[model samples]
Target: MRRLHTLSAVSMALSGAISGLLLPVAAFAILGESVEGIDSSWVFVVAPLGLAIGVGYGIARYYRFSYELTAETFDVTSGVLSVQSREIPYGRVQNVDVRQKLVHRLFGVAVVSIETAGGGDTEATLNFVAEDEANRVQAEIRRLTAAIEADDGDDTRPAPSTEADTSAGDRTDSAEPRAARELLFELEFRELLLYAGTAIRPGAAIFPLFLLLVLTGDPTSLVPESITELSLVALSAIGIVAWALATSAISAAYTVAGYYDFRLERDGNDFVYERGLIERYSGSIPVEKVQSVTISDTLLQRLFGYASLSVETAGYGPGDSSGSQSTVPFAAESRVYRFAEGIAGVERPQFTSHPAMARRRYLARYAILATLVVAAAFLTAQVIGLERWYFAAVAFAAVPPAAHLKWTHMGYYVGDDHLVIRRGFWRRETTVIPYFRIQTVTTRRSLFQRRLGLASLVVDTASSRTFTGSVPTIENMGLEDARTAHENSRKQLQRTLRDRARDENVGLSPEMA
Candidate 1:
């Protein structure tokens, strides 16, 4: 068994001390001492006690935590009170991630996260291990996983010695040779700048507007009694433009910081990626575990002919907060597709657009939304006696173009081995899901869609839910077409499974077969 780096005690002690200090602070606030002017010198007395207790707890925790990398399992034993132990099998490990914050780097330590299939979060975390030791642990897990796959069905094979050296310092002496690595993609500085410039962060943009409103105070107070109306309008316009520029610069800087010096490489069956500037992350996505591949671009990026490619594996989804799944954060659309093809064996697909009625459906939907907006504006005008409320009618002008873009972008294609679905207008996405990876397929029709003789075909996979909280669906297809696609997907899934089973059987020995 191996212990965490000694430095972890320092970090743990700091955390515990902070937590302990919060207790007295909370008590002081709850007691209303500030209003009553109660004596507070007792806090000084409690502070040292908190620090000592915190240090003691930290040291105990450091000594208590230990882990072992066995032949077929990665075992961890931890917890100060009521110790808990877990053994994670090698074959089930989906991703081994190494993360180093600025502090961790200063301490020459890193956190290693082991993620297993069906585990919503990391299965185990080896916090504050030596950087080199972390890498060794990740590599050993991969080597063991590969070995287990190779030895499947061979129950007679002897397990490696349980007494094997598991110490962090000595394990490397008997470690397997590193796999040959091929440079796959690296983000260029110029492309990184372009990506940052084109990236749209609505949340960040809205924040500045809110801040401006809050800082400016009451809206009516912004107009001074001596100021002319025209000058006030001019000042507002200038402020809005300045706010826009400020928000854009802030968003760009954020993107640059996150994706600085991104690099990706293929090592045997896994693709490894490292990115970030202040807080670095290195993660692996096993090729065989990939559930789907997505090529997406925002409206601005699309106009610039750039897109991003990301893969969804059993361990990481696009929605994962870690954000390590993106293989190529920014590249030319053609180049992105080429890289995606290499990863998932999917070519640039020729999509079939939804039926003409789908276009009518979109037009009707947007028109209804515009009409509702106009009606609400008119009602507000009557209630508040405000002029120029008719300005809301301008939304009608956007309905046609918005509807057209929606129809133009929505399409689907059923390839020989993959099902492709494309949707969205502001941020277009094209997802390719392999038949074998698909978990479910279903068809649905809303009341309006039924009237239009249209239905949606939803495709689900083992990949976790996306950030948008939506499943992969090909919408506004002819009812019959949707049903046909649903049935075909089911049949293809079965065929792919059978082919895989046959290949596995062929590799097995006669006795095991």
Candidate 2:
């Protein structure tokens, strides 16, 4: 099986490299270089270089083994010069991730990633496996855990919408294929637009704009005239606007490319998320390893009804991002809330009383804004003179950015099952993470907020993609409210787990109970 994987990858690599290497021949022909006069050393270098390219491809393909199993172990091994193998114990297994690039999908293949909890720096990745085998591998992993639960007399349930799978992997030269459940979910075009919006963030255009500015600058001087023209103020407005538009377009293009026609399918315990444009990619996450599932939306998405999804799971060994995250990319704003719940499959109680600050809530930001406004005014007052009418006019004009910040910053709320946070403009995001998935929750007090008897909360979790990865929120809220939110969420998790246990105990009556 490993050899088969190796051969397939090598073939693909060689096909591309061979085509590229032919460019030299084209160049030589154009220059009228005689083929007969070509040195033997050139062939020696080129032949081995071409062959090494194939080997490189094979090395990357490197799957030790791929198969399905019962409540025991699944083994995969393959490496040529230095053989490496792993026997992943069923109990230690954390998650199963399945992904595919455009190439793999074209070949009806999926990359299977097996993740376990025990190994500190352990990883297992099978580059190209038949989708059937990928499902088989996932099913076997879940089956083993179920078998253990049954033996321990613990009530175990299969995944929602999935039936108990009875098929076993065939152990033969011509093994009978096991059919695993193909769970299908797709993203809406509107959601894709939202995805395009976020995926192409500010940084998207920073590099391109920087490059363009550099191009328009004295390259030999190492600094652009745009930086220098800032003193001239009005002079660079055209250049700055051009830069902003260019960046927006670049970001928009990036958003489109990153998430095109995203799909996620569950094959047993493994979840496969498919996405991308030209350099297509597929990412997988395992259920057991799932730390959290987050449905997030920017303000624009909220208006348009779209959101992006992120899943945090145990990573496959080391250097394996399979269990990391996958997003719908683009989704309509209205559908975001429903889609998020659909993925979570649970109703969390949300407090109807949305937390809000009185109009005075924007006072917290007043000090900072005053600094900027006063400075701008002071500079003008100093340079142009602090004339009575001009000073009054500047003071009034400065009120808007501060007022906008205050209004935008004016929201906070608690949900029965999750916490909701919103911040930013144009890229405003509302993120929802279930209490069950909360790993670390803490609050910080800036010196000023501390003096004001207010603080901020920071929420951190494993799945680094779907969620902001790290949410450091500074909202104008009471200290007690922050603590209560954390405590309530924690208590809810305990109750849910206990309820699950109690509900699973059907024959627990009196003595037997």
Candidate 3:
């Protein structure tokens, strides 16, 4: 066990002094102290005290923080006043991520985050470690985790002699090779631009634009004279388009910055991801922990023959750590499909389309929503004495085609090994979930669905997040199909569990002969 880098104390001291310096200034400003009368000398007095406190705290943290790695578990003990000791078993460790920010990069240090089967942020974080030491620690943990999983599995191979185990352990820590890592995918600048174009939501720009307007006051002068003379509806439309375009550009720049030098590679049964230009990140996920696979494409992506793929692991949130953990952020549809199939251990999800009647249901639903919107706009226009209600008619006219497109693209596939659900009109997503990973299966019906003799099948997985009472569902299936899917899913889950148990019990190990 070793203490953190010496720079930690300096960084901590600087941070504390900066934090403490604000207090006296704030107090003086709040007290209405005159610039001439204000005591600038207090900051000097406070700075050293703050620095002393910070440096003492940092040194205490460094001294208290220590870790020991064993064959089965990595033990960490840390605290300032009250001591906390935690032992994380290698089998339960989900990911070991190494992150280097600009400061850390300058100092040649990295922060190591350890995530486990229990979620809600990482279980442990070791800050400000030497870059080389961080890499070695990450690799060592991964090797230990892999070795533990292999050892726990009922493999019948003879145990390595003590001599061999020690020698093998020594080699495993240093065995990671750049050449051994198979390059699976890389995101280029053009692909990142395409990703931004397809993934950014135009509606999301409204809040930021409104914030800008509030902060900067009115921008009426920026509006063109001809556009300013247009009807309220037209102006609103123009503003939305302009804002969306601006937002898309910002999103493009963010995508490039966040994903520069993005690369994905394979290391044994794990996948390694590395990216970022300014703040580098390296993370790994075990293949066996994958809960579900999703391949998605927006309308623009469809036109460009590109798609994005993401994998969900148990106890891991989609937004946790490296946001989305995209397997392929942007790739040609053909390549994405190939990778998805390989990862999912299945052929393409050629699911059957929803029944033709689903189109009628979609049309009715969208038509009602569209009617309400148009009616609202008409009423507003009437109240405002504007003859711009023609926009309402235009909106209503688009509903039927949009509904038809939704129904045309929506489909589901129930297989012995996996259940696949496909949906979305503007953005198409196909989700493939293994039966063994499913925690529950349910059916739901809305009022309209009940009236239409339709229901939805919801698949619940341990890995999926439940937010705002919403879960992933195969919506608007015929009632009978929904029930059938529910029943089949439950049966598949039970069967898979039983089969796994049987394999573990009977087939895993040969009799000692």
Give a tens-digit lDDT track for model 3, residues 1-513: 555666665666567566565665566565546566657557667656665676577667767887766666778899898999999988888888889988778877888888887865788887767777677667778877777666756543322112222211122233256786777787887787777767765455666688768876977655555443265556778778887778887776667766788898877778888888788988887877777888888888899898888887777756687563677888998888778777776677678788777889878878899888888987876765556665676776887898889998999999987899888878788888889888888898988789888888989887765211235689899999999899999888889788866653211011110
Candidate 1 local lDDT, 49-68, one digit each (tens): 87778778877888888998
Q: Write the per-residue lDDT of candidate 2 for residues 364-412, one digit (tens) a residue.
A: 4555666677677667657534343233345545565665654554454
TM-score of 2: 0.62
* Clashes, model 2: 24
lDDT (Cα) of model 1: 0.80
Query: After superposition on all CA atoms, how large is the RMSD of candidate 2?
Result: 9.9
lDDT of 1 at 390: 83
Report the lDDT of model 2 for residue 198: 52
Which candidate, 1 or 3, would have the higher TM-score against the true structure?
Answer: 1
Q: Which candidate is the best by TM-score?
A: 1
lDDT ranking of the models: 1, 3, 2
TM-score order, best first, reads: 1, 3, 2
